[model samples]
Structures are given as C-alpha cells and as structure tokens.
Target: MRTITLCSGKGGVGKTLLATSLGRIIQRQEKCNVLLVDLDLSVRGLTLLAFQNKYELDRLPFSLTDYFYLEDEDQPALLHDLHKGLAQNNSNAEESQETTAQATAGPSPYERLDGLFILPSSTESERPDWTPLHHLELNETIDKLGKLYEFATSSLHVDYVIFDTQAGLGSLSLAATTLSDMNLIVLEEDDISWRTALNALMEISALNKRLQQKSHSYFLANKVSSSMLDTADKLKAFSFLPPIPFDAWVQKLFAHATTAVLEKDFEQSDFFKQVESRVWQELAVILGARQRTTGNGPRSSWWRG
Candidate 1:
C-alpha cells in the first residue's frame, strides 16, 4: 500500500481541504479502497470538512481519541475499540450492511465516497490535558503509530492511505512523513509562509539523508494566484507538485459550515477540472497508478482490488 502524508509547517494553507477533495476524487476516479486518516489532534476540523451533516460523532461506539488520550496502561483496550471503528469485524453489525458494493470493497469506513475510509484522530482534541512528548523517547508515540498504521493498511487492503497531520513539524508529523512513501507539504503565497515552508522542506530532506533512506516529497503552494504562480515556480525548481491557483470552489467548501462538498458538481468549474486533469494526474504518477497502456487510450484501474 502507498501511504501519503499531507502536512504543513505553517497553518491556514488549505492542506486539509486538499486532502478531503483528493479522497473524494480518488474514490470517484479509481474505484478502489482509500483511507483518509486524520492525524491532526490539535484541530480535528477535517472531520467537519468530510462529514458536515453527519456530525453524530457522540453516539459512535469508539474514536481515535481513546487511543491517544487514554493512559498508557489503558491504551491496549482502547486500541481495540479504535480498530473496530476503523476496519470491519464480526463484533460490528454495520460492517456487513455497509458492503453494498460487490467484488471489491466488502465494506469501508465512509458513506458516499465508496471504498474510501476516514479515521479521525478524535472528535475533539485533548491536547492541553495530554502528556507532553518525552524528548529522550520522542520516537515512541510515532513508532507505535507507524506499526498500527502498517497493520491497519494491510488488513484493509487499500490502494492508498492518506494522513492529514497537525500544524508544524513536530516529532509525530516528522516521524509520520518519514514513514510515508510520499510527503506532501502545502503552503500559502506569502513571504513568511514560503520561507518557513522552505526551511521545513530542507529539514525533511536532511532528515531523510540522516535516516539513510530516500524520501519522495512535494510542496503544494495553496491559495496561489495566477500572477504569483511565477514566484511559486521559482521557489522550488528541482522538486515539487506543480503549484495551482488557489481553488475558489475548494475554499468555499471549507469556509462554510453548511456547504455540502459531495452535492456540488465541482468538476464543472474550470479550476476544479484543471486540477482533476493536471494536479491529480501528477499525483497519480507519484502514486505509481499511471501506467502506459498497450492501446494508449487511458490508464486502467483493472489492477485495483
């Protein structure tokens, strides 16, 4: 499975929204299993972005909060609860009913986005009350999470597992990105944002070399204007996701509380169509989904399970 982590060193750059849209796009286009895991504990806002009307989170049997917020001794039991909520099991009666689609996805964690799942870190972030990271054992939390991540992806048999991370390059974010096959960074078109993002990019590159592992990373300049695309182009010449203008429709989806991301035909918009063709095309290349077909009409999803 290909694991891609979407993170930003600075906030308010629309990385969360991009992750949400890509999840939808992947599900729609590829027709394969996809999981969007929310790792941003401090701000579990992406949950709202994905499931605006389905905000009955309080009634759910379990959530990611239990695994992270609970004490270490109590974590084992909580982890089981997390698993049930994420992947299918006999204990959960809903899993069987959820398998309306045939031959491929038995059941997934999402509703409309067929074969796509979302594992939110929590309905609410309990960051302040939680224990701070122990510097000496900084890798403990992320390493544990990485193992769980591996298990979850393997069991689900998904085509991709996308992680949306917390703001800044903390141990967990840094660790997760290193573990991921591709690290996607998002930033706005401001001097401070650009400079800070560049520093973090350099840090990640250095970290990859230190770990003696090659990492594939790309910087996506969010909220870019046509005029500023030139500036963004010059910022990262050697490596990046070709920066696109800030998608107005995408921004509209996140800013409004009542907006239904699924209801609208965003592809009709010139901006959305361009991204679907270009940005997502590049993304497919990174995911290794693009293959030169024998007939050469278009790439096929014949290999997806």
Candidate 2:
C-alpha cells in the first residue's frame, strides 16, 4: 500500500481537511480501500470529524493512543480488536432502534463508507494522554507505526494509508514523514507560513538524506485567494500541487459541520471540484494509479494543466 502524509509547519492550514477530502475522493474514484490514520495526538482533528456521532466516539474500542501505550506483544491484538469493533459497530448500526426515525436513518456514524476507514488518535472522553509519547524514543515510535502500517496493508488490504499528522515538526509528524511515499507540506500564503514551510522542507530533506530514504515532498498551498496565485507561483524550490481556492462557505462549514466534505452542497463547491478534478488526479498518478480515459480520451498530467 502507498502511504501519504499530510503535514504543516503551522496549524489551521487545512491539513486535516485535505487529508480527509483526499482520502474520500481517492477511495471513491479508485474503488479501493483507503485508511486515514490520525497521528495528530494533540488536536485530533480527524478523530473529531470521523466520530461526529457521540456514540461512535465513546464506543471506539481502540485508538492510536492505546496502541502506543500497549506492549509490543499485545499491540497487534489491539488492532485485531479495533477491526472487530469496526465490524461489530457497522453490524449493530443495521439493527432497528426504539424510534422509527432512528431505524431508517441509514448508516451509523462509524459505518464503512465505500472503503474509507479511520484510525482515530484517541477515544478519550476529554483529551488523550500524550505524556507517554513524549517519553518514547523517536525510532521506537516509528517502529510501532511501522507495525501498524503493516497490519493496515496486509491484514486490512488497504490500498492507501493517509496520515493526518500534527502540525509542526513534532515526533509524530517526523515519524509519519519517514514512512510516507509522499509528504504534502501544506501552507497558507502568509509570510510566516511560507518561512515555516521552508524550514519544514529543509528538515524533511535532511531527515530523508540521513535515513537514505527517497520520499517525495511537495508544497500544497491552501486557502489561496485569487490575489495570492502569483505569490504561490513564486515557490519554486519544490514542486506544488494545485492550490485550493479560498471558499468562505467551506470555512464557515468547518466551524459548525462535522466534516466539510460531508456538507450538503460541498461537492458542488469549487473547492471540492478542484480537489476532485485536479488534486486527486495528480495524487493518483504519483501513487501509481493507472491512467484513466474519459470521453475525450486520456487526460493530460498536472504539468500540462
């Protein structure tokens, strides 16, 4: 399975949003299983979005926090339990409830969507205990994550493993970067964002060189206004994915909605259209998806676009 990590040097640049939207788009378009691993231990943005239904959030059997604290010998069993929990939850969701309206409400919050699975950061009531993570060695963290990666790919048969990492160059973010086939460094158009992004790029480059890894890295400018397109183009050190245009509707939706991708009119928005038509297509090619043909025959690559 190919792994991709979405990271940012700063917060609120839309890493979690991009990760979820990209996973949903790829899973639907490619007809393949995609697992989104929430590695943001502190914020847990993906976890919050995935478990919008409080029942599902409280019922989750295991999470990344639990996995990290477990002994190596017992860790794999937690994943097994996690898999069973997901299946059981989906099955239970199909059963009837007390209210007629509830019975006909369709799939539960945690029900499998096509083939999109989310491995949440934590299932804690208020906040996850991140103390243990700070004590573990960096390599130890990466090793544990590697095992999780193996299970997701071999046992779960996931085609893609997308990591939603913590903002900045934290241990979790670095670990995720080490394992990814591609790292998308998300940034805004502000000067601080750009400077931090450059620092992040340099760090990733140094890490890859030290480990002799060949992971590809790119810039993904988020919340770009029409006025900032020229500014974004000036970032020439690393290749860039198509910029996600600023959408006020999306920003508002994110504040009140569980996930922007699930909003009623989200798919009709220019943001979603750009992500579907441009971003995913570029990502699919990089992930080695076979070229697809449309009514107009094969489409051109991102460079041509």
Candidate 3:
C-alpha cells in the first residue's frame, strides 16, 4: 500500500480539506481501498468532517488514543483485532434512515466512500486521557506513531493510506514524514506561508536523504485570493501543484460539516476541474494508478452527485 501524508509548516493552510477531497477522489476514481488517518492530535478536523451521521459514532470500537494508551501486553492483540475489523467494516453506507442526515436516498457525499475508511481522532466528548502519551518519551512516541501507520498499510491491506498531519515541525509530523511514501506540504500565497513551507520542504528532503528513504515531496499552494496579482510568478520557484483560488463559496462549504465530494457542481466548476486534473496527473501517478482511457475522454467520468 502507498502512504501519503498531507502536512503544513504552519496551520490554517487547508490541509484537512485537501486530504479529505483527495481521499474521496482517489477512492471513487481509482476504485481502491483507502484509509484516511487523522494524525492531528490536538485538532480533530478529520473527526469533525466525518462526524455527520450517528453511524460513525460506533463505527470503530477504538480511536487513535486507545491504540496509544493501551497496555503493551494488549497492544498487539488490539492492533491485530483492528486489522481484522478492517475487512468487515466497509466504509460505504447503504441508503437508510440511520445513514442519512437529511431526507435523501443513497450515501451522502459528505460521508465516507466505498472502500475509503477514516480513522478519526477522538472528539472532544470522547477525548482520551493524554497523560500516557505525555509520559512516553518524545522519540518513543514518534516511533510508535510510525509503527502504527506502518501497520495500517501493511496489515490493513489498504491500497492507499492518507494522513492528515498536524502543522509545524513537531515530533508527530516528523514521524509521519519518516513513514510516508509521499508528502504534500500545503502553503498559502503569502510570504509567511511560503517561508515556512520552504523550510519544511528542506527539512523533509534532508531527512529523507539522510535516511536513504525513497519518499517524494510536493508543494500545494492553496487559497490564493483572486485579487492577488502575479500569484503564479510568485510561487514559480516552489513548483507547486495548481493553486486553489480563495473562493467565498468554498470557504463557507468548509466552515460547516461538508466534504468536497458533496459539492454537486464540482465537475462543472473550473477550479475543481483543474484541481482534479492535477490530482490525476501528479498524485495518481505517484500512487501508481494506471491511467485509463475511454472513447469519451482521457480522464474518468465526471463526478455525478
């Protein structure tokens, strides 16, 4: 299984949004099993994004916290059980009263897709005691995280494991970087964001070089205001993925509980189409998805919501 981690040197650069959207796209278009992991220990962004209906309340018997704090003797058994559960727990929910938030039929676009599972961080109400994590040595904790994700990819048999990492240069982020097959460092079209992202890219690149690891890194510039002049020229040095414009509609969509797949007009929107094209070109190739061609067009069918 290939693992990709979405991280940022600084916060508020739209990491979680891109992770969810990309995961959804990959699952639908590639027809592969994906596990979306939320490694942002402090901020439960992925949890909230997947926290719409009551099905996910008891979807998984354990959270990431549970995995970390469990006794050593029990950890292996629990991990084994978690892996076993992966096959039984299909991410897709059939159309039913329990699955629907509104009076709609079929799975909601906001929910997880078929073969695309989410391992969300513990919510505020269900937050586990973090004292154990604090007591563990920093390096040990980082190694543990890396091992946990490795297990997800190896034992869970997922085709892709996407990590929504915490911002900044913390041990957690480093652990994720060390384990990822590819890293996407997200930034904004501002000086501060660019500076931090450059620093992060350097650090990640250097670490991989030192370790002799085969991980690749990419830059993603997000939320470029339409009024901002010469945005492309400014970000040229970074060789960033297509820059996502700062649209008020997109901001509002993320402000509430929503997913990009739920955007009914996604295929029609020029911005989303561009983003999708880049994903198919760069991310899909990195993940080793064979480019399929049909009589209609080169890319797959447009998203139908």
RMSD per candidate (Å) reads: 6.6, 6.6, 8.3
- Per-candidate Cα lDDT values, in order, are 0.64, 0.74, 0.66
When sorted by TM-score, best at the front, the candidate numbers are: 2, 1, 3
Q: Candidate 3: deviation at residue 153, Å?
A: 2.9
* Whole-model lDDT, model 1: 0.64
How many backbone overlaps does candidate 1 show?
0
For candidate 2, write residues 107-202 as lDDT tens digits: 333334667888888886475334636665778887888877775554355678899988887777888888998888899988888888878888
Poorest stretch of ten by lDDT in candidate 3: 296-305
- The per-candidate count of clashes, in order, stands at 0, 0, 0
- Colliding pairs, model 3: none
**Candidate 1's residue-wise lDDT over 1-305, tens digit each?**
67788888788786676776777777678877778877776676666555555545444444555555566788666655544545553222224333222213334344335666777665533345654342424456666677667656644557777888777776667777777787777888788787877777777777777777666777788778989888766654445666778677666654665235554565565555655776677777756877533334443221111
Error of 1 at 58 (Å): 1.5
Misplaced by over 4 Å in model 3 are 53-55, 89-111, 123-138, 227-230, 233-237, 259-271, 286-305
Best by TM-score: 2
Candidate 2 C-alpha error for residue 197, in Å: 1.0
| Model 3 whole-model lDDT (C-alpha atoms) | 0.66
Residue-level error in angstroms, candidate 1, position 203: 2.4
